[model samples]
Target: MKLSHKLYPFQNSDPTRKSLGDIIILHGLFGSSKNWVTVARFLSNFGSVYTVDQRNHGDSPHSEEHSIRLMSEDLEEFIFDHKIQNPVLLGHSMGGLVAMYFDLTHPGILKKLIIQDIAPRSYPFAYDKEIQSMSFALDGFTSRTEIDSEMAKYVTDSFIRQFLQMSLDRNEDGTYRWKLNVDGLNHARRVFDDVFTFEKTSETPTLFLLGGESEYIRDSDFGVMDHFFKNNHKIKIAGGGHYIHFTHQTEYLEILNQELSFHS
Candidate 1:
């Protein structure tokens, strides 16, 4: 049940005031706790915020397997270890799939749920091309520009290339390494693809946000999604892509604040 976590408590003027609800952020595959700092920091003003490094990512211990069930258990253990009560579960992409599983299995643990850019169904499209691209660039590159040049050939978007590049680290021997557990992740591709599926539905208030330009969620997944999240509202961010939170932080933040207030 032990987790390598970095916790940041939101400071309030009145120390004696009762504990308000907190936010627990889950990052997508290949993403670490650092990915949610911007959103978490902004939400901290309302209450405590936590960003978790999922197993096999970030400073969190690496594991040979990265199943959704194991991930939910890790999250459950994390909440118990931190003694966080009824915290809001916020997740993006792969993280969103984890949140859905958690809410189904541990309904009482959350006050509300926010899922960004994913649905409760399997997306088996081949991402091996992207994985291959990452593998090629993970080796030693003399300069950042060299890395960008290689990534640009596969990633298409400049912003996403930059975001992915942030996870690159240079070793003492000058070889560039990725913070993500590449071998473990690439091996668990099928499991990752099969992570999301509808289970027991909960009455918890659910909020879904999507990037208008992304094909991750659409009319096809809407029927299944509506089944579980009966009291749900999906908001689409115009002029945004898959990582809408990053691309439209201000708009996303405003919408998030409004959603939190609605739940309160």
Candidate 2:
């Protein structure tokens, strides 16, 4: 029950022509609006676009509370504040799950809904070790080399290490701290239980895009996903992982264009 404190950071894209419409894109867990810059620029051709950095990620304010419901309501408030009429809403992974909860609670405002690489089910997460591992890496930050070396010990994946390193904020006093509230995320584990739970179907026209290589969405959850997102479309990006929008930008843009055309 905290203030909606202008939490997320966002970028607005100018359209090439008269704006076709408006769309808001939300990034996945540990991601920020910066990650979607390319996609935002590409999608801006079809409409004015908004890419947001959700709470605890990117440049957003770190709150003591983090939950899908809280984040969804924040989005709803943003839509109303901006007077964004029937804007297309797209979210990836954790953001996708937040989008689903938002639609379920507040329907009819969206022109269309797009969810990527997640389903309407509670996903089991064991991110504590990974998060602590990052903190553990920050034990002694004499230099970036020391930090990187410690991070390498905890996080073996070079790509993830590079991606997560973006969250580090440097102090004038020659110290480094994480931009994200890792402890808040640890406390938010309870919110996971409330990620996806409802019976009534949503009327918002929806598209579910997934990376074929991502294990986030299971075969069993497809039926539940269809149950809620009754008016929906589904696509799988071959050889793509969780970050389909980044890896398959062209294909992702084409699919988005097609959806825009269909809605138009």
Top candidate by lDDT: 1
Model 2 lDDT tens row, 1-264: 221222232223433335557888887776777777777876766677878777887667788878888898778777777777888888998889888888888878787889999888887665764576566645457787788777777778777777677777788888888877777787787765756656767989889998988878778878987888888878998988888887788898898878776665
Q: Total backbone clashes of model 1?
A: 0
Runs in model 1 deviating more than 4 A are 12-19, 137-140, 172-174, 194-199
Assess each prediction's global lDDT (C-alpha) against the native: 0.80, 0.76
lDDT of 1 by residue, 120-182 (tens): 888774666556657774555787789878877777878667777667777888878777777
lDDT score for residue 261 of model 1? 58
TM-score of each: 0.90, 0.88
